[model samples]
Target: MDHLGSWRFLKVFLPAVFALHHFCHAETAPYYSFVQEATSAPLVSYYDYIIVGGGTAGCPLAATLSESANVLILERGGSPYLDPINKTDKENFFLPLLDPSPHSYAQAFVSEDGVYNHQARVLGGASVFNAGFYSHAETDFIKEAGLDGSLVNDSYLWVEKKVAFKSPVLQWQSAVRDGLLEAGVLPFNGFTYGHINGTKIGASIFDMDGHRHSAADLLEYADPMKIKIYLHATVPKIMLITEIGSRPRAEGVIFEDALGVRHTAFLTKDSESEIILSAGTIGSTQLLMLSGIGPAHQLEALGIQVVMNQPMVGQGMADNPLNGLFIPSPLPVEVSLVSLVGITQFGSYIEAGSGLNLAPSLVQWISKSLVTILNQTEAKVNSSSLLGARLKVGIIIEKVNGPISTGHLELQSTNPNDMPKVMFNYFQAPEDLRKCVQGMETLINVVNSKAFSKFRYPTISTQDLLNLVATLPLNLRPRHLNTATSLEQYCLDTVMTIWHYHGGCHVGKVVDQDFRVLGVDDLRVIDSSTFNFSPGTNPQATVMMLGRYMGIKIQQDRHS
Candidate 1:
């Protein structure tokens, strides 16, 4: 077998051995009670805390809360630990991105503008589905968000010990790193998680053996007897009671099991007992709207009684925009995900990843779809022809620290099963588009640098690509522009989301600094939805930090 084939075979074969080793020497493991078909069991009336969403934030938060208080976690999907295909097979890690099954670990969704994306439905949340790139937020982000600086610094360790690891920088990643420095993305900070303004090697969730440790692993901190997790418990709405002329208070949640049986879980009378919605940006916002806590007009139009007239519940959504340059190389690079990142002076982040040869049919479909979406052309050549003697390494340029061109989400219907209409007005701001162009320019420079010249094969240059894009017919341009006005037009056509969706239910608008929903008692949102702005990097580490930070806060409040 060739190098790539040998690597793929080893990845597939080694995991089964690891799985067996893990299963055989199991000691007296903690009794982490879980209800697969929650409907079959008698529903508990109340708990000290009901965390709706056993995901990145929810998993850690529930585990932490269970240390002192009775905690119940409702997950919309199954445990990743139980799935060998998703959890063990590293070669097929990205397969879930294409999975369309309702029970798939990654749930696929399409935006109003035809962009496809997926969100995690399993225990680790997106941490279980993403490419495992991990980085902390910039210090400015911490100050801007008004987070406790010291606590935030210390919080990372709590999560890092459980899942984070320094990625092994390989040949391709090293070349990319050197190229970034050569391109003037200076101050090469060595391996670290701090999000600084320069090139640096960040951590990842994937271990040395290519196995992923998710937020689910943090359940080791949980007092098993105090925590109960229910898989396939789809929460339809947060049950609330609004007294006449008084503020609404969250009572419990009404959910359904995989078997379609309904159940309700409420909070204890201890007033301190709260309902924390860590159901992610879309899920939490949709739940808020479905529970009649969104815009008054939207709720009344849907014939749902208004619980609160919070206009910001689903407003101000922001997703980091990304564009890329594919560089085909004659040599096979080590297979890896985001490791070396270039943080440019112009507020852009550049990163690269190596690829493996997938099945021909799958490759054909993907290539054809990408060609159609990106170039708006017919697939005249067979997919096999596209793959020449050399493989391609993707150089991704992201507008991380850019103008926040926020969008909004609207309810499609009163049905909880329906996905909210997401319109992430990416690059809506001229400054945002300008930043993206700068990012692409930096990436182009990096690829042209001497560090990459040895391995890089001759291909289209940046100027040639731009000029060709400029020559495209006006109507054929993105958003029906009359002309290719500038490189921004090309950006509009090529820019896509990097899956780092944030805002919507933002601080100072939908929720308070403590993450509690305004005008509502005994309720809180503790996910990316609470972020006032994107952290300008892969958000998993920050999300995990937020989980730890909030867990400590909640514990302190309960004790006080």
Candidate 2:
């Protein structure tokens, strides 16, 4: 057989034998065999590509690229297994990973300044715990982030197909949606299953049967060999192989396993190879600073030798602003921040996969159907327009502006567990604050509409402002309210993080528009960090799209 023919034959033959052996020899102590597994074929001195972090973006990129090249995806987490957190059918994957669990491999990182940082030491990375809601920027958001709109949109559509996101198909409890609609917040987007005006959807996950799903669900069905997952691993540093090019080329990555054993994986041994950093905003920025690719002054403070003096490595931080509107609901419904789960009652999810548990209903129920609908009519509004960032399908506002220019992430120590210093400078911009105030007003108006007139909800007037004053911090209170008539008070009271963190390594602010770290070659970042601003809604879909686009680029470069 030719090389291609032989490879295809073994792909089928080996899996069948392995499956039989696993079932029949279930009790056999770790079966030893002379046949080398596919993954162990070679610790090649060089690889065509090395992608760090097998997450929302990483997995798709790694899997797609492996079609033609020897791709090495080094995840801090181990391979995917059937665990509650990683289960294909489970929608509550947002359960935190800080605790010990078979489904997740967790780790922590401290800032070099001994101040602040957070890290995930899992295989799927953030995807293992995210709500699985998928969303993209309005046209304006991309422009604000200084990205090419056409390129971003084209890239987005490509990944959306790969991930196969379906609208929620279940009958989510109507209390939230009904209440919002009564309040005049017409379902923000008819296309957005749950998106209401000023509200966001919960989960964008769809099941294998082409229904509402979760990250675990989609990932579980993906071909295993084509995308090998390495969980419970922590990437400590990136090894740089400086070449004669204008920028220093990244050679490989060094990571530590759960057992504390250290190993080195390379991108290209001798010939030039590309390194893609799919680590989240926080993880990627920290890794870059640690490897001497960040601000010269900050690296010097940590006493690290500088390789590339890119000052914007950890600047321009952005995150979706979240505000909760609680109306009295008499129903005994379980609150799930990550996803809706009521459709299982009718067995619609298990049977025909239609009902309250359907993906569209769940999302509509959570976000009240704001973003999904607006995006359809408000196509003229780009990413920067108020509607684009303020109104999206997910329960988050993807609004952002240039943050305090001085903010940066720096390493506190060389220890991998040390968390990096994080400075969000949230609400530092007057425009951002103004948007929040306006968005809050719009939200309250929708809640008071006739469609949601039931529930006897009190209109959020100046009189009710006193009741929420306590929610704001003591120091920030003065800025929030005085007469209580100003919507700013309500905005400050309910404002929170949608947990869609990005822009730490934003384009122009940190990495270039191509997502490459300035002065660094073969190292591209295609994670949340690459966004100069936050996505208008759930960033999972956008991040995945970025991965798809970057994966193609990696392949092109490798062949060249």
Candidate 3:
């Protein structure tokens, strides 16, 4: 019992006990493995399709294209298995992947304002942590972007079939859907999809055991297969290998893995594949600019070699300015905030192997869209003939006039560790501010409905919050909350970006209608970054649909 004897005994016993406890905890925890990337010579190979950034779009595109020939998805983010962020379940996964310490990509694209941004370095890209809402582009919105209405129709069919897009049938409370319908907010329309036209269209989400699903779910084509998903992979530039021809072809791409190791791949004659850039609006456009396929003046100023003088890159970038109305309800909202309210139902879809929870109720409040068109005004101008043309079935409203975003992404330094300088000039246009004011008014109207009022367990009086915003000083504008009393206050406080940047590389900029970069022959930009207009809804479903549609189209083009 002496001091020395007791201390020696305690040390020995404590060490043994601590070791046992550690082992026990490790064994009890759910076990998953992380694939260590190759540190030696690159594990490079040739394939018919090399889709960079295996994310929201590239993942599905790779899976769909793989059915035809070998497809190599080149992602800068290393393997998804190694990423802890990727292991997240449907709920509470929004804990960002911005920290570079554990995640794959070095520097995330965060706005200086912090209010408007997204974390995009992981395997599933933004889809991994995004609120699962599947919406189609409004027909009119699509048409304004210069695509025919048929494209949207075809895309909707293809996406629903491939991804098994469904709703919450068994687990969800039916009142959630019923309440919205009874509110008169959801006007019935024959077509269901975007907020513009599909008034009766339902929202979509993955059936993650009554949880939620992601691109990871649909991208997994084979079980227990090492499909080579790279995370933290950053494609800095698209390598344009000039083949002896009239025009230079985009032969391959240059990318760096999470380890900061750079590598290049050449498009071979045998596997004369396509290089798809689904790296997102910011990522894809940055890559194109770095590759010298963007605005000639911008490229020249930056001292970048001009491969193609496409002034449209980063030109028509647009995103929806989201404004939410949080009203207290008398009842606890039974609906899961984790999954979107899928309400749309088609005949025989349930019997045709699609689940009953196959539609979402989110699309119920959208306007009816009849004709969707995309007339690229920048590179190819449309005269008075295209203007003032009205279509059948639905009316189109310009909630946000398609003002080209003034945002741009450029390298901070040669070091990949240094995050890119991202500037989103939100509310740069007076029309955008006007749109935000109008959108907020709409949100207030919808959330203030009697049906929505009853969803809260304890009724919340939003008048005080609204009054507070109205009275707050200009310097005291809220960073966390975006509530405002008057239109001026709302415009001043809630004037932030949706973190959904698109159309930077519209038809004239980096890529054309087929999503192909003009100067680069084989390279295509498939991510939302290539959108000509922000598809008047959540951009994920549209991005995924485009991936699937483009994958099939490219495969067919090759075969033909």
Which segments of candidate 1 are over 4 A away from where they belong? 1-31, 85-90, 357-362, 365-392, 459-486
TM-score for each predicted model, relative to the true structure: 0.88, 0.68, 0.70
Residue range 385-408, candidate 2, lDDT tens digits:
212211221121222222222244
Tell me which of candidates 1 and 3 scores higher on lDDT: 1
Candidates in order have lDDT scores of: 0.76, 0.51, 0.52
- Model 1: per-residue lDDT, tens digit, 8-96? 99999999887676565232112255535566545556899999888889988988888889988888888876655334333455567
Q: Order candidates by lDDT, high to low.
A: 1, 3, 2
lDDT (0-100) at residue 403 of candidate 1?
A: 52
lDDT score for candidate 3 against the true structure: 0.52
In candidate 3, stretches whose alpha carbon ends up further than 4 angstroms from where it belongs are 1-44, 78-87, 97-114, 141-158, 161-165, 169-201, 208-210, 222-228, 242-246, 296-303, 327-331, 338-406, 415-418, 455-460, 467-483
> RMSD, each candidate, Å?
6.9, 12.7, 13.9
Runs of candidate 2 with Cα error greater than 4 angstroms are: 1-45, 78-80, 85-94, 97-120, 141-165, 169-189, 192-203, 206-228, 243-247, 269-272, 334-407, 455-490
User: What's model 1's TM-score?
Assistant: 0.88
Give residue 401's lDDT in candidate 1 (0 to 100).
64
